[model samples]
Target: MGTALGTRSASAVIGVEQSLPSDVVVDISGALTNLVADVFALYLKTKNFHWHMSGPHFRDYHLLLDEQADQVFAMVDAVAERCRKIGGQTIRSVGEVARRQRLKDSDVQELSPGAMLSELRADNVRLREFMLHAHALCERHEDVASASALENWIDEAEKRIWFLFECSRN
Candidate 1:
């Protein structure tokens, strides 16, 4: 079957000279591509909240989300390139990202600081869950490099969740 990028198989493109089977590469790359999508979704939502922030804690909350957004955006390239490194194609368009992203977009006209942080915390929790599953998939396939990357990403997601949780507390 064709993959999301409309490619028949991951190894059909230029070979990356890996020992892993084509199916294994395809599975790991698919999981990583999904991570890239969720990362993009979360990054945009963080920026959206950052731009629309208001209230007494505006400065603190705004800066927090801005920093988080930057961190989240930094993961995209590495994840996408990881797919290529494993002989697979990553996301090619925003449409693919949107289609694969599991995070819900927040488009409410306005959101208070607490609501913003809480929503973000929930999303980050979900992101961490996704990463853990990807890590497990890597382990199952003996993809140590991808698993290592996922471990760091999982830690980053946990930190984001903790920060958002603490910030939202009264």
Candidate 2:
């Protein structure tokens, strides 16, 4: 058992066969778990913004967030599975996700459409940064598969940020 990300419960170390060292597996698993948590957090926030979206651009903004939310959600399973494939267990509960998540949650009753887009854009940028950090870790550990996976995710995050930035602009 080892600490999974920053969460309290010790993650059950699995016996998945892989060439990487145990420390590398633990590090990557913790990093990927954090990424998964952030992805889930961002997914829900995107949906929240989509559901509550209003104003002159309601149709367009709503559709955009809905699409982005789907894209964001598409990331979860791949990342979680990557953690497991690399010889560490993935997240098992919503509570685990909440404890490991690094992204901020929104609870505002009202927000301008611009504000929502801006917030999501910022979050995507941060997500990209987080992926890059994990990528760097993979690089340092010579974990080619994990690094390659993070590259695709980083690209997706860039696309999301681009869309949100363009949409939020006046």
Candidate 3:
């Protein structure tokens, strides 16, 4: 007798024979999951800063954070989708995100506008570094699709970093 999906045995699972080796997919997805977590964390932080921003530059800073938050949030879905596309498990919950994320959470107290900008800038730099490392791993595994996605993400992060740095200057 055959299994439900025409498999002769019960051992075979769907998507088990992905184009990329399972190990490579697992490794790439792990990296992408971590990136997703960080992006989510940053998204929340940017929103926090946006909501709490004040002072003479309130409008400018608030709008900047809002736009940045949107950009960060946009990446989250792509990262998770890419992980699933490669036949690997994605982050399942907020706890999973916290466990995988490398970004630090901000304090409940509102930070100064400059302080917020600086912290976000630093986090973006870190995210960019992680993306570069992931890109290299993708290349090593010949995962061109993942590598291409990372390239676009890296460019976006770099622009964010540049804008944040400019905003931070006197």
Candidate 4:
């Protein structure tokens, strides 16, 4: 299979002018898995925050969380599609995502607006690091499509981070 970005997985052997090597697929797959897992992790945090948020910013956060969820979910889909392109299988279960994802699991109960915002901001910043690494890997392979997707992901994530900290900036 192949990601929508036009990268496929097999085995990585970077030599010729035609066809990606099978071993190269393995290398790219490893990198893509990291990307996919990162998106899945961030996805859970946003959705969890959406469901369990409380306090003064409740309505505002609710709407923001929805937007965050949509963004992360779209990224997750792209990541999984990358897996397919690289001849790897996507991690399909929430349970798997929970186990595989590196983001923290917070108890959403009784969290204040400030608390939730802090958590989201931290998570997004961490995710941006992962995106940077993934983007670098994509570039290493000359996978322009994957790199471009990563750029978009970083831009969206940066906006969410700005939104989370908007109040504090004042």
As a TM-score, model 3 comes out at: 0.89
Q: Native-vs-model 2 lDDT? A: 0.88
Model 1 alpha-carbon drift over 4 Å, by segment: 1-17
Instruction: Residues 1-170, candidate 2: write the lDDT tens digits.
Output: 33232322244343353356677789998999999999999999999999999999999999999999999999999999899887887889999989999999999999999999999999999999999999999888766778999999999999999998999888
Please give the lDDT score at residue 102 for candidate 4.
74
For every candidate, C-alpha RMSD to the true structure in Å: 5.9, 6.5, 5.7, 4.9
lDDT of 3 by residue, 51-158 (tens): 889998899988988999999999999988888887888889999999999999897696788999999999999999999999999888766788999999999999
lDDT (0 to 1) per candidate: 0.88, 0.88, 0.86, 0.74
Q: Mark the 10 consecutive residues where model 4 has the least summed lDDT.
A: 11-20
Model 2 residue 112 CA deviation in Å:
0.5
List candidate 3 segments past 4 Å from native.
1-18
Q: How big is the RMSD of model 3?
A: 5.7
lDDT of 1: 0.88
Say which prediction, candidate 3 or candidate 4, comes out ahead on TM-score: 3
